[model samples]
Target: MLIIPAIDIKEGKCVRLTRGDFNQKKIYLDNPRDMAIIWRKQNAKMLHIVDLDAALTGEMTNFEKIREIVTDLDIPVQVGGGIRSVDAVKRYLDIGVSRVVIGSAAVTDPKLVERLMKIYRPSQIVVGIDAENGIPKIKGWTESSGLKDFDLALRMKSMGIERVIYTDISRDGMMQGFGYESTKRFAERAGMKITASGGVTNAEDMKRLIELQPYGVDSVIIGKALYECNFPCQELWYAFEEGITLDHNFSTARKK
Candidate 1:
């Protein structure tokens, strides 16, 4: 499992929104490049970035800044937010974005998925299916898609989408823990590989997620907990640098 760090950018600043609430946002850094560099220096293999401004407005507000962050990192960065069309996806990919995540587009434009997949290959595309009480949320979690996450996932899978990032809006930015059972339900129903996100609190949480690796939860995205130092980040950084994979809880939970 990979420990991917998140950089949520709003108004050109790195910020995080609690429970996907815009009014509840807290700025974490002035420059997103600085945060990307920090995670890169910490030996992160990949970075997850979301443009909060674009997510709500459907504009590439911080495209240049995102380009800078992507340029500075030797690792890949998967970017999301307001990516609606083939041109936007192409523009981002042209500038070195490893994968482009489609949120609202995935729900509103299913044919766009087919077009993008045909051109960029499946690995270069990711769909974010964020849900609240099983219904998929779109347009930065402000609008309901009137479709269950599993239904959306099934559509994406049928359209040849290989990977998806599943985030539970209620748990996002709350540091509660992974929405394992819900994610499992989606994974089982959608039958696609998933990267679980939102509310990952600590190492134990990571262990639990790792254990779900067999259930199509290949990796997870952690934000608040990691930013708040919910676990031994320094040690984990060293381990990442050394290519050391620590068994989740060293078998304590597995013993059960």
Candidate 2:
């Protein structure tokens, strides 16, 4: 399974919020591009980025900063947040983003997703299903969409969406462990490949997720755990980067 590091950008800085609560946020780095480079240097296979500001406001407030990161990184970077229109999707893909994740718009505007599906390859588009108590939430998890998570997943499946980034809001950023059973159930019912997100505490959680690989849980996006160095492998990477001289093109190597 791929361990994807998450970079949540708010006001052009890298930050992570607890349980999707804007007020309960903590800044990790001042420059998100630097953080992305750090992850790349650490041998991250793929990067996951979210625009917290855009997620809440529906505006690409940090587009320039995100663009900078995309330009500098050699690895595939998938981005999510405030992607409500076809133009927004185009802008990201045009700038070399590997994939664009559709969130609230998947609930509010199914046609937009359909239009995107028609325009882009299925691998280039994904839906983010953020849920609380089994009910899907939208607008940065601030409003209830009046639909169950499974229901929304099924709807998206019917709309030609083959993969989803499933996030259980209650477990997000708490470091209590991810919603393993919930994620497993969602994968089983939806029959779609899942990139599990939120509340992944440590290596043990990763082990648990690996067991679900047979159910189409291919990759996971970890935010707080990665930033805080929860994995022992991160320490090794840090020490190696600090002790040795790394080739400038080392991070550009494409390896799974």
RMSD of each: 4.7, 5.3
As for candidate 1, its clashing pairs are: none
TM-scores of the models, in the given order? 0.92, 0.91
Please give the lDDT score for candidate 2: 0.88
Backbone clashes, each candidate: 0, 0
TM-score of 1: 0.92
lDDT of 2 by residue, 1-256 (tens): 7778899999989999999999999998899999999988777778999999899898999999999999999999999999999999999999999999999999999999989989999999999999888888999899999998989999998989999999999999999999998999888888999999989998778779888989899888989987787764444343323344444455344221
lDDT of 1 by residue, 39-59 (tens): 876567899999988999989
Q: Which stretches of candidate 1 lie over 4 Å from their true place?
A: 237-242, 245-256
Task: Write down the lDDT of every candidate, Cα atoms only.
Answer: 0.87, 0.88
Error of 2 at 152 (Å): 0.8
lDDT of 2 at 229: 73
